[model samples]
Target: MSQIAKTKLTQTQLDAHWMAYTGNRQFKQDPRLIASAEGHYYTDIDGRRIFDGLSGLWTCGLGHSVPSINEAVAKQIKTLDYSPAFQFGHEKSFLLAEKITEFMPAPLNRIFFTGSGSESVDTALKIARAYWRKKGKGTKTKFIGRAKGYHGAGVSGFSVGGIPANRTLYGQGLESYHLPHTQVPGTEFSKGMPEKGKERAEELLNLINMHDASNIAAVIVEPMSGSGGVIVPPVGYLQRLRQICDEHDILLIFDEVITGFGRMGAKTGAEAFGVTPDIITLAKQVTNGAIPMGAVAFKQEIYDTFMETGGADYMLEVPHGYTYSAHPIACAAGLASLEAITQQNLIDRVKEMSPIWEACVHQLKAASPLVTDIRNYGFASGMSIAHIDGEPAKRPFQIAMRMWEKGYYVRYGADTIQLAPPFTTEKSEMDSLINALGDTLKEQH
Candidate 1:
C-alpha cells in the first residue's frame, strides 16, 4: 500500500475544503476519498480497489498516472518552472500547439491556449464575437446555444449554456438564446446516432428569424453532449447545422472539450460526425487530464482577421489570455500525452473497443426497470433514471453511491448516470465495470 493510503484524516481537514459540483453535506456524512490511481483503477484512502467507470470525469481516457506524462511534467517543472504568458514564447507550447492540429479537422490549424475548459469556452465565444467586430460587424454579438448544452461554468459559457440550474442562481448573463434540444421524442434506447432527429437542426432557422443573423456571432454545440447525458447528434444533424450557419453567415463552434482526443473513436467529434466547424474548444484528454490545459482551434481565416485588422504590428489583437495560457509544464504534459496516443494508436483502440463497450453498457436496460433511456457513442454512455417521489436526480445519486460502495466509480449528474471506460480498457474490465453498474441499478429501487 502507498503511504497516502495509511495517513488518517480528520473532520477538520475535510471541513476546511468545499467541494465543487458535489453534495457537500451528504458527502461529509459519508466521505469517499481516493488516495491514488493507476491505469484503470483507483485506490481509496482505505486501500480498496475501485474500477474507474467515468475515466476521471471523462478527462483521463488514456487512464490514470500515465508514466510518460508524469515524467514529462517532472522534467518540465525542473527545467522551466514558469514563463510570462503574455509576451513570452516557449518551444514546447509551440510544438504542442502544432501537435494538437494533427487531431483537428482541416483549416482549423490556428491554436490559442487557456487554463481550463471554462476558459476555453469563454475564449472561443470571445473570439467569435471579436472576429465579427474586426470585420466591421460589431452588431454580431448574440450567441445561440441549444437546450441541455453545457459549455462550461464561466459567465460567458454559462450565459450561452442551456442548463437551467447552472444559470438560475447567477443573474442575467450574455445576450444569448437557446435552440431546443434534439433528443427527439421516441428515440429512447437508441444505439449510436438516431435517424429521426436530423430535422431538429432546422430549428436554428427560427432563432435566426427571431434574432437576425446579423446580430448572431456564433452557434455552439457539443458534437456529442457529455455532461448533458452523453447525448449523440442524429445523422445529418451536424451537417444541417453547418449548412444553416453557412447560409446565415454565422460561425459554428464545437465544444469538443469532453469528446475530443480518443473518446469518440476518432481524434475529434467533428471527425466522428463528418462536419467541420469554424472553431473547436478542447480540454480534458488534451493532456490526458494529467495537467490542467485547454485550447481553441480556430480556422485560418479567424486568425488572419485579427492580424490583418490590427492598426499596428506591435498592438494586441484579441487582448484576451490567462496567466497560465500555455504553462510550460502543461505543454510538456500535452506533448508527451499526444505522442503516447500516436505511438500506441489509442484512437484506433477506442474505435475497435467501442462495440464491446456499447454491448456491455446497453445491458443495463434489462438490469433495471428504472432505466428510461440509454444512449451511447464510442466509449461514452449515459442512461436516464426514472424519477422517484418527483425527484429526478435522487435515483441516479443513489445508484452511483451504491456502485461506489461496490468498488466502482461512476459520475451521476442531473437525471442520469454517465460512464466512460478507459480507452485502453480490456474486455474483462469493461464487463466488470458495466456489470457492477447493472447490479447496482437493480438494487436502487
Candidate 2:
C-alpha cells in the first residue's frame, strides 16, 4: 500500500466513510484514498501517482484535475453556489441546456436535469410511462430493459436493470420486463461491433408480442453494454430494435450514462449504432464528473405530450426533479466541461485513437490463463477469462487487484475485467495501462 500522510478528518472517519457499489469490509481493510488527481493519474495520500483506469467511474472524460473546469467551478461557487431549480431561472442552467441540445438529434431537443445516473434513468422511465398516459394509453405502463444492461441503482432503474445481482436483492419495482441481453459470448475477441445482434434484437419483438404492444410503455437499453462486461451490439441490432419499437408503439430509451459524450468515438451511442430513441439518459461525462449531475434527453413529442396533459403550467409536469435539478454550480461545471470537450476536440480524439484501442483489445487474445474473449468498441473494452467453477469473476478480480497494487487501477466483476480509459487519455498512458494489464495477466501463476 502507498504510504498516505495522516490528513485532517471530520467525525466521518473510516467507520463513517461508507462507499457505494464497493466491497465495504474489504475496502475498509485497505482503503485507497486519493488526495488529488491530474491528467490521467491520481495522487495517493502519500502522493504516489496511480494510473486512472476507470476514468473516475467512467465520468472524467477530460481526465482529472482539469484546470479550466476547476477555474470555472471556482468562479461559479463565489458567484451563485445554489439556486432554486423548481420555479426559478438561472442563466448557467439555460446555457448548459442549450449546449446539450446542440448535440442531440432534432426532436430530442428537450433536457431535464437530475442528480446522478440513477436519477436520469428513473426520470426516463417516468417520462416514458407518463408519455403513454398523456396519450390516453394509460395501460401502457410496463418497461423493458435487457439482461446484463445496467441503467443505474435507483429503485426504478434497478427494476429494469438486467444485472441479477443488482436487482434480485431489491424486491419489486415499477412492474418491469427485461429483453434478452445482447452479449454474443460466441463473438468474444471480436473487433468493433459484434457480428451477431439481429437475433438478440428479435428478443425485444418477442417480449412485445408476448406482453402485447399496448401494455409495453418503453424499451430501455444501453446501445453498447458497458457495465455488464462491455457487451457490444451486433450488426443490424439497434436498427432492428428501432423497427420493433416503432411497430409496437414502444418508447425506446438509450441509457447512455456510460456511452455518452465521446467515450464511444461517436458523440453518442445513438449516433454510433445509427439507432435513434425517444429518450436518452446521460450522466458521468456530462460535467466531466466535476459535479454530480445527470440529464434525460427526450423527444419534443414526449415533452409536448406532458405539456398538453391536464395540468397547470406552474405545476410539476411529472411531480419529479431533484432539489438540485438544474443546479447552478452543476450547470457551470457542465458548461465548462462541454466547452473543454468541444475545444479540445475530444470526440474526434476518440476516433483517432480507436484503431490503436481496438488493436490493443484484440492483442489480449493470447493473454494467459487464456483469455476466452475480448469485447471492445472505441475506447472501452472487457476481457473474459475462463473460471475454475464456483470462482466466477475471481481471476479478473485478482488481476485488477494486482494491477492496482502495482500502480494501476481497473474494474473487475462478472467474470470480465473492464477497461475504460478517459476519452482524453494520452496514448502513452493507454500503452502503460494496457502494459500493466498484460503484465498482471502474464505474471499471474
Candidate closest to the true structure, highest TM-score: 1
Q: Give the TM-score of candidate 2.
A: 0.96
lDDT of 1 by residue, 174-220 (tens): 99999888898889999999987999899999999999999999999
Give the clash count for each candidate: 0, 2
Task: Supply the global lDDT for candidate 1.
Answer: 0.92
Q: Give, for candidate 1, the lowest lDDT window spanning 10 residues.
A: 1-10
In model 2, state the lDDT of residue 158.
88
Candidate 1 residue spans exceeding 4 A from truth: 1-7
The whole-model lDDT of each prediction reads 0.92, 0.85
What's the CA error at residue 357 for candidate 1, in Å? 0.9
Worst 10 residues of 2 by lDDT: 1-10
